[model samples]
Target: MEGFPEKGIKMGNMTIKDIAKKCGVGVSTVSRAMNNHPDINPKTKELIMKTIEEFNYVPNNSARNLKRIQSKAIAVLVKGIGNTFFSDIVSGLERECQKKNYSCILQHVEEQEDELDIALHIIKEKKLQGLIFLGGSFSHPKEKMEQLEVPYVLSTIRTAGENCEQYAAVSVDDFKESYKMTEYLLQLGHERIAILTAPKEDESIGKLRLMGYAQALKDKKIPVQEELIGYMDAKKDRYSFQTGYKLTKELLKKTDFTALYATSDTLAIGACRALKEAGISVPDECSVAGFDGMEAGEFYIPSITTIRQPVEKIAKATAELLFDMIKGKEVPRQLVFEGELLERESTAFSSCHESVK
Candidate 1:
């Protein structure tokens, strides 16, 4: 194996990747060896540790050493406060923190606020051991992330390309789940399906879900209609019931469709109310579907058809991962959970198809 510099010499520029390269092992293997994961050969682990010691390299500035301050506190930064879909996930995270005997701080972040900036300030103010970002568009420059001294996890947050691998994340594949919903509607013989989604410039989950909807239509030989796509007003909208109702009302003016798909269950409920006021019967006159299997959707007048995300499971995994990262036991990785498509009373076979029958 290629050896690094002599002991007692500080290699300021050395990194974990560099050490892995010298050992001729994969980055994950190097991580496992450093963390004593028990799966690696004892001889290999010793060699890796020796190499690390020789270069005087520190992984993320010595995880255990940073825990010396003894602050058993963590913070959860939640964006889009009014969205009910995040409630369970937040609750689960808090419970996990409690089980670990750590204090959990929940902070709401506004639409325009920078979560990272807030986190940096809070980390200093509260002396947090670690943190988790609950919901937001997390697309920050590496330099900005490097400023975060403690380990953190992204829970139900959407990150841009290449940037995802740089940190640990727990979320569903938005594009795939959206495509599944769209395809379900399509399979029910619904054409000209309308979609209420994020703003036109959204680059996070909104963009992915929108792309999925479009792809499903194209595959079914249906051309995507511009008027059928409802874009939320990001500056003024909070992904709340009012936003969905307002968007649906506006959509009602310009076009007609057999089915309407909302990106969230909260939006789906609002859309149903708008359709009801407009003298439209859900799943009879028109079909409706939504994402996020929130509790309100189940108890609504017409139970909403949605994509059920495993929030509790996701929360447990996120806590485990963040704590593991803090203890120098794991590396940053993306964990995608599958979303189940729940067919409920809100959506049915398109009436247009029934007319032909």
Candidate 2:
């Protein structure tokens, strides 16, 4: 029989550590191989599995619940339900989980719901090994975070008014990217530039982007006009197409500007629809630009000029950091990526600017 030795080891005598030692690999590596994680080298994984079978090793039972077998799984808390910008990031995270042989659970939190509370509940219910928070703002009290015993990462989201030293985060610098976009529009000779932004009370990336726009106008010696700034409704708008259209329509009724900068591609596309209905030509009568380069914006009739965030890079980094944390090989840290500006069809030199120059 090609199986256990004739002089068999006692049942449950071989622990994971013993298996790992027999396989000449780390405990984590052995665990990954046992779980069929793709990150492990194929030959090494085969060796580890063969050793496990030869040793008659059995995995440990979870202390949390004696009746249930603990799984190597993680959860991702997605704040915005229908936000397209988060779709690709979510998919990337799922792929990473597959490589690590961990199951990924995607849970969406409502606009007014508390994400941390949701996270705590899910961690307990699913016996999650780790977690990732995607989208939304995080400014919870330090003690609240302490309640989460499992390793976690903040992906594509910024914490406001918090000591970030104790958390791991992967994201683009929203303020810097927003500033770059605003400056680009300004250089195109748009003096009376308008912005479609987050609600006034927003404290996360929305607030950062808005600040970038204000600072850019200030640096240019252009007085910021309150009338030209459009704010979305917190209750009804989840950065959707309708929100963008509605905000632009309201801005059109109140002010006349040469350029419109939206904080997201979804909002920019919505603004374009509104502008089209009002008989204003994009880059002819008014220019439009956006942030978070979504695919829809690229194929729009008047392609959007926007800041393209490195979503795939951010997502991969987030998975690596979270896994490192879980392995006790890394401490809390922040990773900020730079965005690229793609100047496309929607923005151009202002007609008034040419006349003035």
Candidate 3:
């Protein structure tokens, strides 16, 4: 090094040679001191470390992690990050990941197809350790996930198809939950119970939920009326309040149902609004209930009776499954949770008829 300093190598703005000269030591001594070598004096090592900090020395994370061979970041892909349902799940996921010293990166792919593409890209490019698929169904075929060879967990409200055995999933027993809700309404002396649900045959959950509604009526010896069933495509709006509002308005004009079981809280809330505006009393003129005990449902005028899914538990279980898969542990292919019915002011005895007019 021309005069041992002209090379311009610096540590904390002081050239390595300058540090060595200042400590009355050789360049080897300075290097050892900076690296905290056992041969270096404690005072020298402290001075070197302090100088590095004072000068705002930055280490390259990529280079550092290259030595570790693995990243601690996990990727989360969902339909919409703004949705409260997804937010609650994310909260649970973050809690679990934090405890395990892993960072979570959330990505919202509005389209299902796009989400599949991104998930594949993340596995190949970002080298993500694991992925958590939240809310919506995967657009790609189940085989694609197996082909990509990545650890993933699905936390959608619905269960996956038969081909989705490679990944783990957490979902509620939609059929049993919906059937129980319908049975409860029927037990309350409701004969004309209507179901607002997404199209059947789209997935097991949707079809099973609708089946439960139909079965409950059939079990009680009530004839199944095709007119009482409202079908929407979850792939299409998935039962928004506006969807509920419009559908209920139409249903009221077409049929006189005594009770309504909406597939989602948003739909039920919309239904309630439409009924109130039409001078129809809730639980009196029409007993209303919904799935997914969302917080907004509780504060709605008269509140909403709903089947409450264990969203947090689902999230936690989903994360744990993915974590196990990431660590090369075998997990169950399907994990199903039960839902609880939260009876509230929105539902009442069939005889409690208080006219709004």
For TM-score, the strongest prediction is 2
- Give the winner by TM-score: 2 or 3: 2
Best by lDDT: 1
Off by over 4 Å in 2: 1-71, 355-357
- What count of clashes does model 3 give? 0
For candidate 2, the 10 contiguous residues with the lowest summed lDDT are 1-10
Candidate 1, residue 124: Cα displacement in angstroms equals 1.4
lDDT of 3 by residue, 112-216 (tens): 356677888887777678888876544456656566567778785555366655457788888889899999888777888887877554554567688889888
Compared with the true structure, model 3 gives a TM-score of 0.76
Residue pairs clashing, model 2: none
Tens digits of lDDT, candidate 1, 225-263: 999999998788767899889999999999999999999
lDDT of each: 0.88, 0.87, 0.75
RMSD of each: 13.0, 6.3, 7.3
lDDT of 2 by residue, 77-145 (tens): 998858899998999999998998778899999987889999999999999879999877677888999
Residue 190 in model 1: lDDT: 94
